[model samples]
Target: MTTLLPNYLGGRWQTGTGAGSALHDPVSGQALVRVDATGLDLPAGFDFARRQGSAALQSMTYGARAALLVQIAQTLQKHRDAYYEIATANSGTVRNDSAVDIDGAIFTLGQYARWGAALGETRALRDGDAVKLDKDGLFQSQHLQVPRTGLALFINAFNFPAWGLWEKAAPALLSGMAVVVKPATATAWLTQRMVQDVVDAGILPPGALSVICGSAAGLLDNLQPFDVLSFTGSADTAALIRSHPAIARQSVRANIEADSLNSALLLPDAAPGTPAFDLLVREVVREMSVKSGQKCTAIRRIFVPQAVYGAAADAIATKLAKISTGNPRNEAVRMGALVSREQYQSVQQGLQALSTVTQVLYDGRAQPLIDADPAISACHAPVLLGARDADGAQAVHDLEIFGPVATLLPYRDLAHAQALAERGQGSLVASLYGDDAQMLADSARALARSHGRVHVVTPAVAQVHTGHGNVMPMSLHGGPGRAGGGAELGGLRALDFYHQRAAVQASPEVLQALGL
Candidate 1:
């Protein structure tokens, strides 16, 4: 019997007349469980989070809240396997992939706790007595990060159900604001279980964490001035939500990290059989297969020097050909399926769009290698596309196939390569390979507009592995323009997504009484 996930609201369990939601295993295409989301007490939940949750969380000092975060992470670690078991249903992610999302999220929160403790009190700015202006010492200025007086609405992506929720929740909670996590409907099972574990663990006060099942139809209707909405998804949805009158009229805090055509550039010095070429080839293949290329930070674009274009293209194709695409449960399968039918269609459309700009090197459509379970874990095998004529075409810059699909674009020189890479408008990250300091610095600036995180791939640096698909807890996950300007996992900057900062001034005597 599957354990049905219950609604976590006001520190108790309850479900009303609303219809239940069904979840299925991607590998077996079998029913996992039915979640009760119908007739949820949303209004009451919101009131509790604001009137009760916010106050309870805010009453604690930053240190206390950070301690609580560590405690919740510990509890989550105890039930880690349970989360991995449940996650396999919605997305056919392999054990390692699921573990990285689940355990990595817990570690991210734990790390955030340490960061919060190091940053100290929320009231960061304090005046020493008073700075005398005109020798009177009557004036003073103060700055602090006060909790926004309402709930934080976190709408997560389906690609990473656990990590997505905790990355935003950890920072918001540490900053003394209550959170309402709304995972994508496709993978809410793990979210519900984790929330239940959090409640059972008793690490948080009532109303600190609330879970909403079903849809977010009315989530933005009555938003308050202090309310925050952070979204991670497609660009179209981001635009629609950003334009909502309530978002602007009430001045809500809205952050977005949409998928973008992120690219990687190989330096002119890199050639086939050389160290740089080896690094570049490995990166493109790894990003394409990691999480089956469902990550927002995955390398969707590849720019190589024209001198080694043929070798790079062949290398990528050979790697893709050798990959085994099937159910995650199968040890032989290296790539898993998309989340659902909708995601499969989205990935297909992206591939079609790429065909318009560049030539498909290994077409998944022409010779499809279907998954073991045709329905659940069904997605195309890894496909590589490259520009037919680099001088006459500008396709790789604008085209983005968001799956186990990659496009290779060739460039004549470093300057031309940077120009082609920058044409993507903006990206989440870009990898540059070379040992020359001057070339590396130049490429970094050229890719400045497009890349948020720039990774330097060289022979000296390739020995140790730094997780690429996963964003670091201290760095930003978002890029400019299409990449969704708002950032995630940027340490204290993540808090800025929830709080409203203002500089206040008053008389020194008055400020002294107010506590300088």
Candidate 2:
């Protein structure tokens, strides 16, 4: 029998009733572990975190809390190889892909530690300089932000089991809030192990961190008014969370990251064979193959100048064709399987939906896998689809395959390209590639209205610019409308979600006495 991963809650480790749900290896279709939350006392856990956890963290200064982050990072770094092993077994990710999740998580924790240390020995943050309420300047009003006296509940998606947890936890913890993580069940082992290591090291105060690896059924139901919730998943589930009584009636804070059909555009200035055009193709292939295109920020729509649409499609296809998909354990395999067979089927269905309006520019469905059984493994090759008429391809804009699949679309001009890109409603990012400075700037400016981030790539910064899908801690990572109108991870700005902002109007002398 596979070991049922224990859930950490209420300052102790507990196991749920029954045999539990099995977590499988995506590449081998083998059961690795089990998780079940049935009969767990979730209400007690939340109360404990809100009380004991909150009090302990609030008593510490920002620098003290930062020290905890550094310790956690160091602890995880010691077991770095172990995390990669679990990721390959459970997430079916290669070394490079695993680094994006495990290493990214460690880096985020350290980054937050450095940023938090800069805050020094302070319990609350002053929002802005005090402003005089009257002409005499005797009375002033100052805004301040303090950590919320509650816990943060994170519902993360499957694609990034490691990075997703720490990215949210680092900010919340640094802001002096306790955290409860619900990693997606399909790939929960790595998350569970990291939490276990931290807990065993006793680096944090009791109840400061907890992990519930099974059904999220009753997790949100126990939330209090002061509690904050953040979710990264499908739009349907995001809608459910938004409408939950805990969020709607009780006024619980919520942040959501949902469906995003991000785009990448090749500007007309960089014609065929130019550095700009080549950069666009290279980036697209990287985005599509990395994490098997399961990234929420991955580019779904490729828009190129109508004159060079064929060239861009062929170029991207040529690069994608070289990526070998199979078991991550194989040294030669460049791409791995989906997180599960269910995700594989979903990708197939999404492909069928797009097939109505788009033609297959490059299909890797027939490509042979390396040392993996096609009948059992969930592996899938990268696929590239094309649409001749950008405006008429409604499905291309509305649907996302959530796998190694991307569609190529042709635009008439820069204005048409911007318009086509906006059809995604709102997206996490839209990248523009070209050498024309003015055109790139104008297009980025226009795209920013609909996209949370507009990445401009020129020949100059081609090597230094971060990849299109990478979610750097220094930039905003969420979008509006269909992409879920939420914001996260912009340096210290992420702390805003876990803090309560209030403006105190008082005499200048009284405000000065408060010491901000």
Residue runs of model 1 more than 4 Å from their true location after superposition: 1-4, 120-137, 363-371, 390-396, 507-516
lDDT of 2 by residue, 320-373 (tens): 889999999999999988999999999989999988899999988778999789
Could you tell me which 10 consecutive residues in candidate 1 have the lowest summed lDDT?
122-131
lDDT of 1: 0.77
For residue 205, model 2's alpha carbon misses the true position, in angstroms, by 0.7
Query: Using alpha carbons, what is the TM-score of model 2?
Result: 0.99
- The positional error of residue 228 in candidate 2, measured at the CA in angstroms, is 0.4
TM-score of 1: 0.92
Best by TM-score: 2
TM-score of each: 0.92, 0.99
Model 2 steric clash pairs: none
